[model samples]
Target: MITRSERTLNYAVLVLFSVIALFPVLLILSTALSPDEIGAGGSALSLEFGNFAEAWEQGNFGSYMRTSVIVAVSVVTLATLFSVMAGYAFGTMQFRGSEVIFYLILLGIMVPAEALVVALYFDLRSVGLTNTLVAIVMPQVAQSVAFGTFWMRAYFRSSSREVVEAARLDGAGHWRTLWRVLVPMGRPAITTMIVLMFMWTWNEFLIPLVMATDESLRTAPLGLAFFQGQYTAGTSLLAAGAVLVALPVVVVYLFLQRHFIRGMVEGVAK
Candidate 1:
């Protein structure tokens, strides 16, 4: 229904915004590759790729990355599983107090984490979980599950009634109907949730900061903070470290971009 000029204008606006958003990323990448060593400089784009290596070694990013991967993977897996089951129940089944409980769960998303993190630290400490990876991961899982439940519930609620009725008529029980049918059909929504959870878990900072006192339990962002302090004068190294910290999130989004975008657009349309 749109005219050609309108479409062209829309594309131009999108391109302009894309470039504006990407400028900072490009600037960081350029600085990360810029020559840091003395007497080895040519242009700003000298392509001193060793800066990443030097930063990695100096920053002890390997350990930080491992911890982040562990926390991220654990939080995402547990949160996604729980969210799917909870969303399925809330979306499809009827029960007493269901609305009340669902709204209570929604409070987890509504409440600011900063408000609860201090108390949460003490609660975990009472259980002897402080300074452990469990402490770092559990809170994030709880947080992600809240939003994931909301996300998946919306998807399932609006899913095809005919498809669900057909599955029931085929003698499929709830479990079979969910895993064998609806879950498979909800791949885009699920993938979107997974990507989001992974990014959030990977980048979480405050929870890890409050929970972990041990150096080995530090997540990438926490490590990056320390790395920044240590390398205050080393701009190239700091830029490279930033890139390293962000690379996993970028890779994940790139890998799941199609499903993520489709899910977002569909959710909006519905």
Candidate 2:
């Protein structure tokens, strides 16, 4: 059905965007591999692979990575669980004040984090949670849950009524139906949410920056910022640190990309 000209045009557009997306990544890799001893005026084509090791050692990435992993996993796990339950309740179950409560929760998604961050920092400080992993994890969990609830609620609402009826007729409890019936079928959507939440939590900066004063509690991005500030002249090392911080996110996306794409497509079609 497509003409040759249209096909060529599509290919051209795809190739153009592909380069646009990859150019920065290639530049970073080139810079990271360049000799760390060279000044900023040096070309970025050297093969000094030891830049990553030097950056890792100098940046104290081990602690930063550990903190990031813990915060991200905790946030995603708690957020996903809470979002699924709230989403199912809002999407399927009818009750008094359901709409009001759901809207209240939805406001969490609508509100910008930047707007509430100062107040949130004060609240956490009042509770003596500052400079702790809990400070970083809790706020992100709330934010992720807000969006997750919205996403899962849409999925549950659009799911087959026949399946719900069958589960009910079999006398399955709400929890049973959710876990045994709906969840298995919702793997794509759930995985998509997990991948998204992980990326967001891993890359989060503002919360950690404001909440964590301890050098050991800094997340990867925050640590990278500090590393850049301290090592302004170490261009190759800075690039390597950037790559190290970003690598986990890339790995996670690659692993869940199929499910993430399928979920997004399905959500759109619905």
Candidate 3:
């Protein structure tokens, strides 16, 4: 069914796109491994391992890595739990105010994090939670839960409603039905949400920076900002730090790629 010319053109386009998309990643990897002492003389092609060595040491990445990991894990866990709970309620439980609550939650997407950050900072200051890991993680979790609840709710609505009814017929309560039935069936969508929330939280900068001034509480993005601010110019070390921050998320996505694609496709199908 494929013509030779068309096939050739497709291949050419794919190759072009692959290069365009991957060039930055390749550049990051190269810079991450380049010699720190090379100091702009070293080409990306001739990168050594010294750049990462210096970056890790100078950036205090070990501590940043720990803080980032803690924040990301906490945000993802809390957000997913809250989202799933609310999604189940909206999708199954009947209530007069369901539509209103759902729409209000959906409105969260319209509100930019930056717009509310000023008020959020002062509110946290009043509670004396500023400059703490909780300050960063709490806001990110709330933000994640907002959209996450909507995503899962749509899936729950369009997904196997019959199964839920069957569970109820079998005397399963709401919690039991969600855990035993919807959870397993919703794995594809849930996995996709997890990947999304994790990526967003991992890369989120503004809230973490504004909420937590302590270096010890900074997330990867916040630390990256500080690092960039300290460096304040074109340098491979900052690029290497970015590489370090990006690798984990990239690795996880590669592993869950199937679920990610499936979630989107199934979501659209529904």
Candidate 4:
């Protein structure tokens, strides 16, 4: 089934992309481990995450990391619950203006965050939520709902309906059928969504910047920005902070690699 030219072409493409993707990561890792004032000397210098400890202490990234975890977990948990319910209803139930309302929600996926972010700022201020962790978590939860709902709905749409129908005929309530039958069958999709949501929310920066003005509430990305303010210190610390900022995401992707692949396959099949 394999032709030499075709196999060579595919392998060549993969190798090229692999290098493209890995180049930046390698650079970051090199930057992170470089000696103090390393980046200052030249771009070609070989380095590692040597200054990470100093950067960690300087950024107090432990606290920042904790805040990020709290906000990300909260947003992922809340969004997953809301999106699953909304998606299930939209996928399976008939309701007035369901299509229209879903289209409005879909608009969120296209709308740039910067466009509505100013309005969001004022609205949160009006509610006295500015500078609060809740402010950051809330909007992310809302935005995540759109993509997550669309994804879950796609999977649910392709799924077998027989189990659900039989449960309904056996007097199982709608929620019961959804919880017991649908969710179990949709594990692959759900796992994928969870990983995606966690990654997005974890990396989110703009909303947190606009919302959590308190120094203590600042997340890793925001904290990185503050960490980079060089009027007070050198850039080596900043490189260290960068390594910390990227570490958790890399670890998660590596661990959840299997679940992520299954989710993508299942959702595409749907």
Question: Residues 148-218, candidate 3, lDDT per residue (tens digit)?
Answer: 88888987888787888899999999899999999899887888888878877888888887987777887
The better-scoring model by TM-score among 1 and 4 is 1
RMSD of each: 3.9, 3.9, 3.7, 4.8
Relative to the true structure, candidate 2 reaches a TM of: 0.87
Predicted structure 2: lDDT: 0.84
TM-score of each: 0.85, 0.87, 0.87, 0.83
Rank candidates, TM-score, best first. 3, 2, 1, 4
Model 1 agreement with the true structure over 92-188: per-residue lDDT tens digits: 8899998999988887776767987999888888989899988888888888888888888898898898999999999999899999999999987
The lDDT, on a scale of 0 to 1, for candidate 4 is: 0.80
Off by over 4 Å in 1: 1-19, 37-47, 258-270
lDDT of 4 by residue, 141-254 (tens): 888888788887777788788888899899999999889889888887888899888888888888888888788999999998877774344455676787789888889889
Candidate 4 vs. true structure, TM-score:
0.83
lDDT score, candidate 2, position 224: 92
Candidate 1 local distance difference test against the native: 0.84
lDDT-wise, the better of 3 and 4 is: 3
Clashes of each: 0, 0, 1, 6
Local distance difference test scores for all models: 0.84, 0.84, 0.81, 0.80
